[model samples]
Target: MKKYGFGVDIGGTTCKIGLFETTGDLAEKWEIPTDTSEEGKNILSDIAASLRGKMAERNIGKDEVEGIGIGLPGPVQPDGSVLLCVNLGWKEKNIPKEMGDLMDGIQVKAENDANVAALGEMWQGGGKGCKSIVMVTLGTGVGGGIIVDGKIVSGAHGAGGEIGHITVNPHESVPCNCGRKGCLEQYCSATGIARLAQEALAQDHEVSVLDKAAGISAKTVFDAYKEQDKLAGQIVEKFARILGKGLSNIACVADPEVFVIGGGVSKAGEVLIQAVNQYYREAAFPSCVHTRFALASLGNDAGMYGCVKLVLE
Candidate 1:
């Protein structure tokens, strides 16, 4: 293996760049703003310039570097071509070719941002020492990455791990951002949890702490649940049931060794794991019922780690 590599994780607002030892230790990290202006035409150029500057500053030659791995916030084909990336305003872009060319023919690999995060977790975080894991990210919306046999299952069309859009309530009227109704995101995401709280509050029920809370969020509900608030308990029960069932279905398909939970709502800590696990255990297939559940430990850096691992492979 080469002595060093670079991991570039591109987001809508910023691109996180990390210089790393091939042994998996991060050497240095920095960020560059993503210039989405002009349809993001300058995004790659800016990243390339920053990378070159870093190399010069460290006095490192390209010969000592393994490659650069990029995590993009959109579907990535097996050949590293992206048809569309609304977040980056990219269309018909071939990431490896473009970035590799910019870097003087150095090796480059790219994958969906969520997929890389899952790979990162599998490599050095929650799922470390495991060969397979399903990472569920419960932020404003639900996002997921599936790693099986130590590789990302991006699937045909690069949409394999989109667990959030899975329809949990087919008969519901509300549509997801993807324009489907009753997606798992509708009830299992942070926004979903808060929405559930709002629906509960609109009804006649027992006096609860949430009634007087400044704002209702997943944290508020979990906090109330910790305090044994009956209404919060009900809301949490519903949220957990839906998420657990969703994961149970995933287990039947992917049969990963573990489910690594991450993103904003996962901040609830052990309470979130226990709550979801309780229902997952009840509904999971017999053989998959024992699949482990753990919180994601890497937080924001997971994508960069995964990107770096991409080239290591």
Candidate 2:
């Protein structure tokens, strides 16, 4: 194996770069602003230049490098071609082909950002030691990645692990950001929890700490639940029921060995895990009921780590 590899996680604002030993040890990490001007024409070239500069600074030769693994914000075909990536202003681009040409034909691989994050978690973070796992990121909006047998399950349209879009409440009149109604994101994400809290507060219920909190957020709801607030408990129960049930449904399909929960909402920690697990246990198929649960340890760096792992594979 080569002695070195690089991971590039491109976002709308910046591109996070990480240099790593092929053994999975991160050597150094940094970032460069993403140039989206002119339809992101310069983004790949800029990344290539930055990587070359890094190798030059370290006096490393191209033969010692394995290649680069990239995480993009949109769907990627098996050949590392993107159909459209609004975040990067890219309409139709072949990531590996373009990046390889710029890097003088060094091998390159790419995958959706969320899927790479899951791969990162599976490699050295929460799901370490497991070959199959599902990673759920609970931020403003819900995102997910499914890895089965150490490979990302990017679907035909590159939307494999879209756990959030799974319709939980077909009766829900409110539509999700994806223009769908009653998506799991409507009730399981941080924003979803906040929406639940708002709806709960709107009802005339018993006095609780949440009633007095300055702003209702996922944090406040969890905090109130920790304090044993009656209303907060109800809200959390509802959230857990939906999320656990959603996961149970996923278990019926992917049946991963573990579910690694991450993102800001996951910071609520054990309390959150237990609540959701209870519902998952109740609704999961008996054979899959014992699937483990864990918290993602890599945080924002997960994508970078996954990108490196991609190249290693």
Candidate 3:
């Protein structure tokens, strides 16, 4: 095995790069803007250039490095072909081939960004010490990654672990970004929480502190809930109920040992976890009721760590 490897997380705006020992210690990390102009023609070249410069500066020989493991913002086949990445202006392309050609003698592996994040958590973050885990990321939209026996289940068509798209409210009138209605994302994401708060505030003229605020956000709702605001408490309960039920559904299928929650909304801390756990326990099947819950520890570095994990695997 090589002594070191590179973990590259390609996001829509910036690509986060990390150097790591094959044993999983991150030696260095950095980021560079993702130039999406010209249909992202220069993105790969830019990454290759930056990596070459870094290697030269460190006097690191190519033989000492395992390979570059990358996380893409879209579905990726085992062969490292990306089906599409709207955010990066990418279409069907073989990532490993192109990247390997750019960096002679260096190998490349790629996986979906969300799945890589789950692997990252499983390796050294919230899911550490566990062989199976389901990670739910509650950002603008909910994202999920499933890991079992320390391996990612990318699924056929590379759409496995799309937990957010699960239908939680089949009756919802508005369509989701995926052109479907009632996805779990519509009710459990950060934007979903804010939307719930807005709907709640508009449905009733009840006296509340939220009405005086400039805007309603997930943080605003959580802060109010923490302060013991009655309306906020109700809103949080609803959010927790929906999220917990969604997690319960996932548990029924994946049966992971732990459910790691991450993303911006997780900053609400244990209160959020406790609330969600409470609902999860109530809804989970008896056989899975004891499933543990945890907050993701790696934060934004998770994807990069998972990227390295791919090469190590």
Candidate 4:
């Protein structure tokens, strides 16, 4: 008799579900498109149905599953109520109750997505042996997760590790979706890369090749960097400076043993890591320079794997 668990990572774009052995190895994965409407119950119902179907197909009973865990792309209260999630259009919804109801009394744990990602990294990715690590995802928006002493730090109100929302520039004041200004995300995410590239293109319309590549995005900029596009270099360099400063700030407080960078921008590989590390080393406090920067190893599966880690832990 083998024990298993179900881990679900619910995002605005998709819901990733994984069935894993108690040992944390993912056995199967599935996904469904996310519908971010006030009708979030539909999402919960669908997940329940999916899990039931999986159990039926495998000829397994619910009793065999140790628990069901979820990572939501929103603030999950300690009591399992979602305070607010712009991505899911959820407001004050008791996600644990709702999800448990669907599962007929199965135990469920819910936490913020970033925290889950960190758990996933610790379970199967680069942070496996480490006890304290910070995982940063640089996608359209930036997100962060902190793992300390082998536990996810979900602060009061479950808003712990909201690193992207950290204010890097109060005076520069660029708007963030969190309704704030000058957040670290505004300068370090893939969206930020595009914003920076656009600004550079605006500044020098004549000399750069990006002008010819109108509608260029972060990918284009990275490609251009490989081709030695002057504008792209300038933009990424600036991005590195801001990103490094943000990491250093995080380091000062968390004093994490390792800083893992993941998401779309992370695909830029060594160049991005090296540049940011250089900045982190310079800006970080004396002892903080010892933290090593590494690329995220789990990729998209981190969320699902993390959910498993949460419940099994």
Which regions in candidate 2 have their CA more than 4 angstroms from the true location? none
Angstrom error at residue 32, model 3: 0.8
Tens digit per residue, CA lDDT, model 2, 12-79: 99999999999989999999999999999999999999999999999989999998999999889999
All candidates' TM-scores? 0.97, 0.98, 0.97, 0.91
Clashing pairs in 2: none
Instruction: Give per-residue lDDT, candidate 3, residue 34.
Output: 97
lDDT of the candidates, in the order given:
0.94, 0.96, 0.93, 0.85
Q: Give the residue spans of candidate 3 off by over 4 A.
A: none
Q: Which ten residues in a row have the lowest lDDT in candidate 2?
A: 155-164
lDDT of 1 by residue, 181-253 (tens): 9999999899999999999999998999999999999999999999999999999999999999999999989
In candidate 3, residue 40 scores what lDDT? 89
lDDT of 1 at 85: 95
Residue lDDT tens for model 3, 135-199: 99999999999999999989987778898999999789989989999998988899999999998
Per-residue lDDT of 194 in model 2: 97
Comparing 2 and 3 on lDDT, the stronger one: 2
lDDT of 1: 0.94
Q: How far is 21's C-alpha from truth in model 2 (Å)? A: 1.0
